[model samples]
Target: MQLNFFPLNFQFTDYQITDVNYSDELLLDLRRRYNTSHSFFRFGENIYLSNSDSDSGIDIATNTTSKNVYGDNQITASLIKHIFFRTFKKRFISYTPVDFYPFRFFSSKEKDDLLFDLLPNQLKGRIGYKKMIEVQLRLATIAGKQQFGFVINIARNWIFEKNCATLNLEGYNLLNVEVLHSEIYPGSCGILAPNEEFIGIISEIINDETAKVLTNEGEQVFPLTELFIRKTKFNIANYLDFALSPDKTSQILNHIESKKQEIYNTKSLHTEICEIAKALFSSKLDGHSIEFMNKDGFYFTVQDKPLEVTNTFDLKTPTFIFDPAGTKTNNNNPDLGLSNFGPYDSISFDIKSPSVLCICHRENRGYFSKFLADLKDGIPSSRYFIKGFQKKYELTEVNFQINELSAFTLAEYIRVMKEWDQEFRPDLAIIEIPNEFRKLKDADNPYYQLKGKLLSYEIPVQYVLTERIKTYNEYILNSICLQLYAKLGGTPWVLPANRSVDREIIIGIGHSWIRKNQFKGADQSKIVGITTFLSSDGQYLLGDKVKDVAFENYFEELLNSLKSSFNRLESEQGWQEGDTVRLIFHIFKPVKNTEFDVISRFVKDITKYRIKFAFVTISKSHPHLLFDPNQPGVNGKGAYIPNRATNVFLDSETCIVQMLGVKDLKTAKQAMSTPIQIKIRTPQGNYNNPELNDMLYYDLAYIVQQIFSFTYLSWRSFLPAELPATMLYSNLISKLLSKMRNVNGWDADRLNYSLKRKKWFL
Candidate 1:
């Protein structure tokens, strides 16, 4: 291989090989004659040495005599040495003397480029060109290796302005040794090197010798072509080279393009959805007036009253009014709403288009503010196309009677909204609702106390509740409308989407602390500890699954795109065996999705074929009946209970013992002490059907693949399915589901419907 070497910074000083050595005796004699202390030698006013003996000036003799070795013709090697010595002495004397004290090199600030600032008055000027070159050499060599990544190259016209320096780095590659050398000098040349040869030598050595060694066979490795060089106040650092593969680079470009498209798509969708929503909720009114529908009314204060009714001479200007008669408005903000349509104003003249706006409520705690700050810092400014502005208003919370809310109170709320419209005339309004509404309405729940108080006002208002309701999508949309109506007085334009409630619940299970240590044998190892935590249980449960599935499909598409982009051919048709993935299944209690029930039954229906299976139950307060069954007694009935003589202890092996239907610390301890052959302890405890085990696994694989799209992603940190657990689980599930789908006598949808109709969820 042809290796190219480039020493990054070798130009400042030249390296020379020498055979001559000065004798210690000679130096000692010279010191004494000069009357200089042996520790401090001085040749003249400015020339001095740290190791010299005398302070007096001293000079070495240039006289030389020949020495015969073979006695053939006299060879004058001594003469040649004398000539070199004499010449060096003359050159040294001719140049101005400058003392380079040891402090210049040994000083604490020697590494600092600003060391000159810390110099002693007398020693400052003594430190001149020679000392500077020495410092520069040392710094360059040290920084070269440390700062070898993140290279920057400047265009010819690039100019950098810094304190005490202005660098016009024309056509400068930060990695170039010459450029670095130039940066060390004073004045214009400080940014450009005087010794090009020295720089060239450094470049050669860095490119081949040092960098090559580091790259091919060293503890550190770096990319050669992409060698990085960075500059700072102190010094320049260099990194060896690395280059991105063409395919990877192309993939990144594609990803960027996809991101741009996604942003565009989201904005477009928001606009369309907003338009549709606004059209549905708008109502027409007389000139310069508009009406909107609302379930919960929001409160606002008008700072100024509009002009009284008067016939104006100029008929062209549009007139806006808040309330013809003085009226009171509502206090608390509500979100319940519905779609309505209305004319912009009663006048025949067309109203100007309302500006669509989006508002997010101010979080009481600073958590959201901090999150936004982090987002602002982390996300590139270019990524956020919209400029987000926010403002907050403080108002007293008021409660109106239910009758007041429906009629006069409602009118007052509308009036306040109109007043707000006169000022900002906002097209849309956004509001936040309490997230804990379930407890309030149930049995004098403390949570709903506020809602009840507001309802007593009897106002026809818009409101959004913070409840985990089933199919709550419609509620969310209406709440958005309500906020708009409450704020705009005259409806501007706005839309909202419904929220989904079928609230999901997740359960986590673990063994109790006391039982964990005492029950399991001390000598027995705890290698596999099973703990189950609920992923999600609600109407929108597994909603993330859709995204995952899309990502999976996207990955496949990406691969295909890669092949086409690079024009590569696939060797096989259809999906190869290795391409298929296995899935793990987890179901939270109180599943509301009818489709999932159908899937559960399908697992049972295909149980004729023997299949391995596992199951667990999770609960915090009560032991599960299905999994934590009572252990057998001496009479084959039940074991002795801790509190009641007639009651038996529950079996720990049962899935029911697990909290949240997943293995946790508590259940793990129980399993350790329990007998291994206790078949009843296994998860599928309810059904000893071996065929169903395989079918269950098969179905799980299908579900995960269908949900996530790709089989490549792996699941980590599970109790079982060792080595490649999630993959294996997914594979098995897929196989089972495929078989069920093809079963001879079953209808796919019918099977699904059965699971929903029959609550087989335990």
Candidate 2:
């Protein structure tokens, strides 16, 4: 009636064969196995024993199955029924049906085999199964050993990259992509700090020039204090280097490369460059002065006065001197003709009255900042001195702007002077060309293009102290020496200055070469001869080093520098000089590929053409400034009247003459061209209305004789356009008059024709 189940020892022990209903040991063992396999479930209470034939019995059919479907259906139906058993097994069973109760209870061993059918299929039982799952609970327990090991690995890599690699990049928020403070370094005390700009201190041990002395006594020691005091030389070679971490350096390099094309394509930093340049020009040049202001102070001045001249050609401004020989005049007369032109005299204002008023241009700020900082450090004082201009001349303060990209912003600067100095009508104006002009083209212009832009006003301007050089030469010392004399106007003997024949001329050629070289290269000191050029037509050329002797030198330096600096750069990724050249030049050679001769030719053609068509208005009178084709150097030289000659004959009869000393028809015509010629009336020359013949003869002859004396000079060959009407080479009219024959009034071609009166000789 009572059944006890226990674990059975399956291997036979020799004992009487009495089969009990249950053994406690066997039941415990079976129960333990069941709990191990299904620990996720627990029974509510003890369940009643069931007879083998009870309703909870197993269906005996096996290979000959009856009620269930087969395949997936049969498996699924079987699973549903097993699930119910699992549910029912959880509750206590107090009774069973009498039909099943009338039978003996199955032994524990027998029941184990029978209950195998109710057991969950192994594959299905494991599906969708979960045990315990609060993750943090295990982390706090000793059982979570594996998870703790994982977190440590992540921390190590973060620390390594941050400290060892010196990577500038910091951890970022992966979700929002927000930048984190990881870019900053954390201090020892766990304090966060911003990125630092470097304060580098270089310590170098100097090798003593003098050997140390050892005293014979060996006790005496000479302290290092008296050893030697060679100066310490430490310059921040590249300021950007201080803060440049490897990552940051790489980043910047990448950025630069990516933007190379864009940067070169852009004309200027901003449009302000052009606007600033235009703003410097004066609307009117009635008064010739300009104003300038800077942080240092403010000042102004009238432009240089016009040079006085005895002849019309004396009015000529600076230009490439062509005449080999002529009477030289006072050097102070800027227009006095001198073929041996060099940077002999560059006008400089007394420091006290420095023409360079204020440094108002924005681009100048960088220079001023360094200047002011250096001044505090005793740097500027050692390099420069200041003095005042003479008090007699009045000055006008001017202000203006120029864009960074302008080539001829210099004109705008001059124009501004003209407008401001309108009152006294300053004869000379001074201006500061912006440093922006120093920019070398990325790719030099092709077709050797010559380009220039006009200022706001059409005021005439010239270059001062222009220099050019080529890639293969170096002539800096000479240039500095000349610049000193030309600009500072002081002896530069200390700089080892030596004068040579055609030095200026040679330097000028060199200067062009240097400019071309610079356009092609990168050295700064290859510049050569510096000079100015002008024409009688009021074309004033005043670029610094206009005829710079060292231009070739500078050009060469530029080319070399460009090659050295850019040769190694990869071509495909970013900007290079090649790109710049390609953009500007339809055809270009690589920096390393261009030959010196090729560059030189390009520069010559470009410079010549740039100034070739240059129309000038030297005088207000059209006749005085007319082009003379007959002159071999019409465009290059003879455009100006010859020195010492008041009358410049454009043609046999048409001429430009000085106001004073009119002589004959030619002299009279020349006088007509004077801007401020005085009208002279002679007793016989006036009859209420002076006849052209009378004015040309008596009046003109008397005036010339009185003013010019009896000085008869040899006649110079006239310009081609000034060819005489007659083939006679003689200056005498008698020879030409001999051809005329006396005739009767009715048949004479010499009979008075009213048309002769209307047609003046010209």
Candidate 3:
């Protein structure tokens, strides 16, 4: 196994800077004077010149300062990054700083040639396109050794240009746009000026020439000519629908490969960096130079040769209990397991006479009737709802013509259903929606309106796309039935747990941002936090506590909800005094010290039981890639993909796990899969006290193995999910809650009452 990292060797660890009183204004002036000269750069509050020569007016100090370049020091990292930015300005046409290292690179091609030439004629002038390449120089400490490397990928950004205002001369109603500001400095790189911009969402079209724009500062009036519309993935997708032909797609891919080879290949990338390093060192920067550890004229390389210091955990295939007697079981596959032995709690499944209501266009009545019949009676060679689960359902039909599936029509239908038969509430609804509905705004979308109304009546729905009905097969039916069973409050299966003396609870924290208006992007978006609780066996306990609040208040609300849930669990589970309780939090991204501070304070307050906790972050966006030379490839071709479940320990508290492998790829054309990086936060501040540290001592191997097992517990599908059920469930809840908030009169609290224990989000 080979990593992308290379080691660096510095000739000297010391440098000198001018001793001057630090202020924002002085730092700005110094940057303007020397930034373009490739002589000085700003790091935090000080300006450090590259050389000790007295060319500038400022006096130089004789004293030398040192930075820990090998360790996790921010000053050293920032200095190296700044040097790279200044050097690369003369190479790339334009650059946008994403972080200290990662940058988006633009070419020097003509602006007219950069547009997406394959777009339809009608959309050609309305959308702007740019071909960008993302590159990052990563530095990290891996396996007790410091390393550095580069990762590169292609980025195709579809922008809405200022010409959109001219295209729609009548005036724009609701639009999301970005306004360019020339005065702002574009980070450390001085390649371009207009890249410094801010977002504005147009709410009301005042006239053909002006509009009311809402920004972070406040609502203001701006001329249409000054605003450039902002296009998101969702917005661009509405027009192209990702409908590129095979030839066009192949052409684009070939162009990407050619560009990558020109700059991002290992040989070319190393040469470019080495050239810059040579120039900088030759200039005698502060009378010192930094060099990389060279081996055969190449940077030092690291490989997973012995496979030492790495731990691999193989999780056992979970078994399903299909009968009350616990006599029948299967562990290989969920679909075959359930088909052979039925559901785990089939005997106690109370919805024996389930009912389904169908809604579709009147013209498609025959198509839906056949579709529902197959679902109820089981398609050929497919185990379905009735025979497989031993439950029959009554069917109800409702039809509407084209352009009739409106909010008014849905409300009237619900009213008529309630009036005709007081006891005619259906257990589930199967609605066939057109694809065009996806293009509408949330406030005007019939899909959201229908779902919100159905959920209010305590009815779960299964929406079937009209385009997919023709291509539905046994595999699709199998997956759909599994979800329907779970949504109807039935347990299909659970992961076999290794019983322990201590009780453990896993909590997953996920969030989504909600803009004030879906069409008009807002500067400040509210956050919706979703918290999910599960037992050690991966059985979801209840619906998440979804709260919508400002960003500043999210953590406080999360802490309160967690405390209340823990208190309830302590009493309900009959936990005794001095009993050990372990809480492991699996969050989506790395959080701040404040999160730990709040959690640590909460644990200190509990005296009845001894509590231990670990905060683990599982991220997939890091610039790390793992390649194995020994692994076999498809069709006897070379493939560097590692096997699933392969874990490499980066350090004591961090590891990378490959959840998908060659077999997981549906097609050979799929891009290489990247593994998720799992990191356990180290306790800091007061939490690092000797007594508390002892309580927080967690086995990193066990925590990772448990997470892998939980990935098999997502009831939505038979195949294992990329992420564990904890994070998956929380994310699903957050997204749904965020969208439903736009529905008029929709109450999130109602979920706690009616669908609290059911997997309705599945």
TM-score of each: 0.17, 0.16, 0.76
Which 10-residue window of candidate 1 scores lowest in summed lDDT?
A: 147-156
Task: Measure candidate 2: CA RMSD.
Answer: 46.4
State the weakest 10-residue window (summed lDDT) of model 2: 149-158
Predicted structure 2: clash tally? 128
Question: Tens digit of lDDT per residue, candidate 2, span 212-328?
Answer: 222222222222222221111111111112333445435534543454333221121112122222222211355432332111111122122211223322332112221222222
TM-score of 2: 0.16
Candidate order by lDDT, decreasing, is 3, 1, 2
Runs of candidate 2 exceeding 4 Å displacement:
1-508, 511-762
Clashes of each: 142, 128, 1
TM-score top scorer: 3
Whole-model alpha-carbon lDDT for candidate 2: 0.21
Which residue ranges in model 1 land beyond 4 Å of their true spot?
1-430, 433-583, 588-600, 604-613, 623-688, 694-762
- Evaluate model 1: give its lDDT: 0.22
